[model samples]
Target chain A: MEAFHRIWKKWRHLLIYGFILGLLIISLRLLRWKYVIADQSLEIYIGIVALFFMGLGVWVAMQWFSPQSKTAEETESIPGQEPFSIDEKALERLQLTEREQEVLGLIVKGYSNLEIAQALHLSVSTIKTHVSNLYSKLEVKRRGQAIGKARKLRIVE
Target chain B: MEAFHRIWKKWRHLLIYGFILGLLIISLRLLRWKYVIADQSLEIYIGIVALFFMGLGVWVAMQWFSPQSKTAEETESIPGQEPFSIDEKALERLQLTEREQEVLGLIVKGYSNLEIAQALHLSVSTIKTHVSNLYSKLEVKRRGQAIGKARKLRIVE
Candidate 1:
């Protein structure tokens, strides 16, 4: 039972994907039989199969390219807390100052430093300093790289 | 020539998508012929028909989904630039202190306050302060809402 639980937890995503793919294949086969085996049913069957496969292909592609989950609902609920041990190490690598990290968040949104400073009510120089610090800690030289790193780390989005 | 350029630019993504979907349908038809079709010549004919319809389906879907030019690459290049523009007032709704923004990023990654402090090399109190500020700026009482607001503003992810 314990082993089953662990496998279920780890492979749920794969199981869901497999289930969807199985349904698609079965649907395709049904359409094939309905059309190829019957004369009057041919055109409608072909149309249905084409539509189903095309829709399935596009849906699969969308899932493939969907944004990584960063919703608060996904983040805040601790599933036994131990799941975060690996993430802790990634955070350690950032080495940001508290304020700098805050600025980095805004910077990732493609905010100009001036806009950030105004939003934060900090001196523009202070905002710039935090941004430079963020760049260093993220090991990225550009705002885009920092944002990419943050996303990869799941620190944002 | 100018008209051709205009049309090409407008329909480039649709054309690429159509080409890809066409290729997929062709491959699927080929697979079907190899496995299911008893007559080789008939199978080849069916494959060609499948490929044609697949191409047509993709063209139609492209016309459906390609009205917005917000490609994935473009979205990644500039983080907050969504295809649809929101109201200007909605844009101005939430503003975080630079430091609060950074903490929010780490928090979204399921970081504890102590972990966030250590990562940012700040005292726990300072981290808490930033967190509180983030909550206030986002007008949410919980960490999850802060993350949600950050996402909505495209501030973090």
Candidate 2:
């Protein structure tokens, strides 16, 4: 089970790198055997070994470079309020209550409504009222639009 | 301006390919120099070229084998539903009227309520009510939740 989990974790990287390496090996062997072969059987044997190594090399490289496996701490993120200034302006224009702004931030990050309610500790209805008020203030129609405008205005960085 | 554009269009492929080929040549020279003195330079140079050609061959192979970008027609879609289905559901649950669904779809796609109102021919307050309804139905308490739910369900795909 542990071995299976390990393989699943690294599968995407392994697949990409393995395929690239396999291509490299096959081309190298074909070229070598075509030009350098004196005996047919000998050339075929060398070609097979070269192909295997190439495939292995690619798999290793992919494992080395897979981006999805990076931990959160290693990921890049903007620090603090500097990114929120534009959003503040959008919020002001939208006349969103303070609570709505907080919720809006999570929305941009792709959280579900249930998740946001849990985070804010507010009744879903109250949250809805604030969102509605915000929609009127911003003169926008859709949630996607609200998020986009907030990002554009630096309201929810 | 036209002459410059024409020239750019005509030679773009040549310029790009040439630059890549030039880089390969330089890499080969560097690798060859690391191996030996002038006595073995010719043999080393040949080996380096072979490596460079092998690299290019592998790159071409990868391009050939990789999946092509998806087209709109190729996308799997659910029938008899708005493109943003989850947003529609959230809107319905919130008790937003027909106009609200239109506005919410636009918002999730990154439009402002005002723009949605203008497009939908509704008053700003009406748009606000719809947005509020969307927030409540999604139980998010914010415009962000509505949008996030929409995306998760492939409503925007």
Candidate 3:
């Protein structure tokens, strides 16, 4: 299924266009069957065909590319092989700025403020501001609390 | 597009069925034009219709649910939720002293030397010595690095 899905995802555009062209040929055959309609009616017939195909398109999209499909893939994933990923939800909920997140990550690893500033090539005072903001956003009073909360919440990895 | 998608996702089944039924009615009308075919051929025609619609479905799914269509919410989903466990092997390899192990765990939980000293009923100077020893054993120069290394090595939960 995974291999089939990969090929499907890669060649989907070509496949779709080819199918549409095939349908067009079929429609032309229908036109030549001595069932000649007026020009205006021909346009309407084409519209109906397009709409039907469009409905099919929407159904196909939902089946394989939706969030539900992603969830299914995740469940089928092998255990203990997936790489570490940060808790995006917690990060968003805390509304940490990119710089603050960087600072927080460093802090979690045990870097002092001066070391964090040096590593980031920022001033010590600037790192200090970011650290304070991190504390406020994380709603923690001390480094230990922040570190514990960050790990417990899986905010950093 | 997001709003339309929300509505479409909610009512897609109804929309798809209604569309298929509408096409069926149109096909019936064509059949009434005295274009009767053998039963086997009729089955083939239905198969063709089904295949065409399947193509259309695939096309539609790609357009609306593909990676390019991602919203902020989609990107913020929490991934695998694995629990923390101490790596006994790594702990053994590091050969941290009992006091150092306690200090390392506290440090991971965000404890400062003064706090760790207070908690362990040791002098601040003694806590600092234990911290230095932990840093050397962990091969880290800073608290941040130690914390990061400790977690990565799973030496502390």
Candidate 4:
């Protein structure tokens, strides 16, 4: 063990450097391959990649803001202000089952998954699955966004 | 000229190979430099970049589908069915001026920069600037995406 420790101490830095060098070489190879497959010219590859990302980012931005505007139109979002219109269309689009809807309501009411399970006389795992399904339907990750989008879509109220 | 051509033909492939090798070496060195500058260790960097792209692709897919779901609710997509809701909000957020809007319309209709300039009775450089500005606002690079996104956002319609 002492000898092993000694070897490790002596070669630790070299090991790290070697690993880093290997990674750089591999990454450079990938870059070079991409550069070649993209017409074997640096300028062309760069121009392509740059434009590709620009188009992609713009599309993403448009996707993000279009929905926001559709939902927020004529409904100025003051702090704690409720959305005036309940988007029944959006709710129908989400396709949440009745059980998932129950779990979502309790979730927005600040109940834990276990608490929701007990309240609904379901297993904790079942509640978790329901919550997850609801989140998937709403395209949200957290309780807050789930609740917010649910309200916005009129899935909750 | 004959002698020069004779020697050039003899050494042409060698010269090309040498140039390509030099570019690869330079590219590799630059890659090494970037990894160092980013304060990234190799494994962590590779892992992160891989996962980031995977996550980004999944999110993009979700976004692409979510809007489809919202728009296609109860009305399945038929062939050549026009998007019912024109996303005017996306255009409003882009902050395009009147002239730029006109230039964009021409661009969508397959007018070249020169054509747009002549049609608008403006200089080609002015048209170029307007096109560039429209691209900047739309966050796109290619004319196809610019036009497609414009139509999607209902900026043209």
Residue A37, candidate 1: C-alpha displacement in angstroms: 8.8
TM-score of each: 0.33, 0.29, 0.44, 0.31
Report candidate 4's interface RMSD in Å: 17.1
Q: How do the residues B1-157 of candidate 4 rate in per-residue lDDT, one tens digit apiece? A: 9998987766664566467546744654565557554776544544443334334433443333333223312132223434456567776898899999998876654456764665554678999999899999998765655765676687764
Tell me the tens digit of each residue's lDDT in model 3 across A1-157.
9998988866675577678768866865665453665454533554455566657667545533432223322233334565667788878998999999888877775667765665565678999899898999888878767888997888886
**Tens-place lDDT digits, model 4, residues A1-157:** 9889768744664566456546744764577545545555544443344334334444443454223224332133222324356555555666778898788777655577777889989899998888876765665545644554554455555
- Stretches off by above 4 angstroms in model 4 are A1-87, B1-157
Return whichever of 2 and 4 wins on TM-score: 4
Cα shift from native, residue B155, model 3 (Å): 1.3
Kindly list the per-residue Cα lDDT of model 1 for residues B1-157, writing each as its tens digit.
Answer: 9998987766666677678767865665655545645565533444455445545554454344321123322233433333544343543565555677677767655455764665564678999888887777677766545555565666553
Comparing 1 and 3 by lDDT, which wins? 3
- Candidate 4 chain B has its poorest 10 consecutive residues by lDDT at B68-77
Listed in order, the DockQ scores are: 0.06, 0.13, 0.21, 0.02
Q: Please give the CA lDDT of all the candidate structures.
A: 0.57, 0.52, 0.66, 0.58
The CAPRI quality class of candidate 4 comes to incorrect
Q: lDDT winner among the candidates?
A: 3
In Å, residue A81's CA in model 3 sits off its true spot by 4.2
Candidate 2 segments whose C-alpha is farther than 4 A from its true place:
A19-156, B1-14, B19-47, B50-157
| Candidate rank order under DockQ | 3, 2, 1, 4
Judging by TM-score against the true structure, name the best candidate.
Answer: 3
- Scanning candidate 2 chain B in windows of ten residues, the lowest lDDT window is B65-74
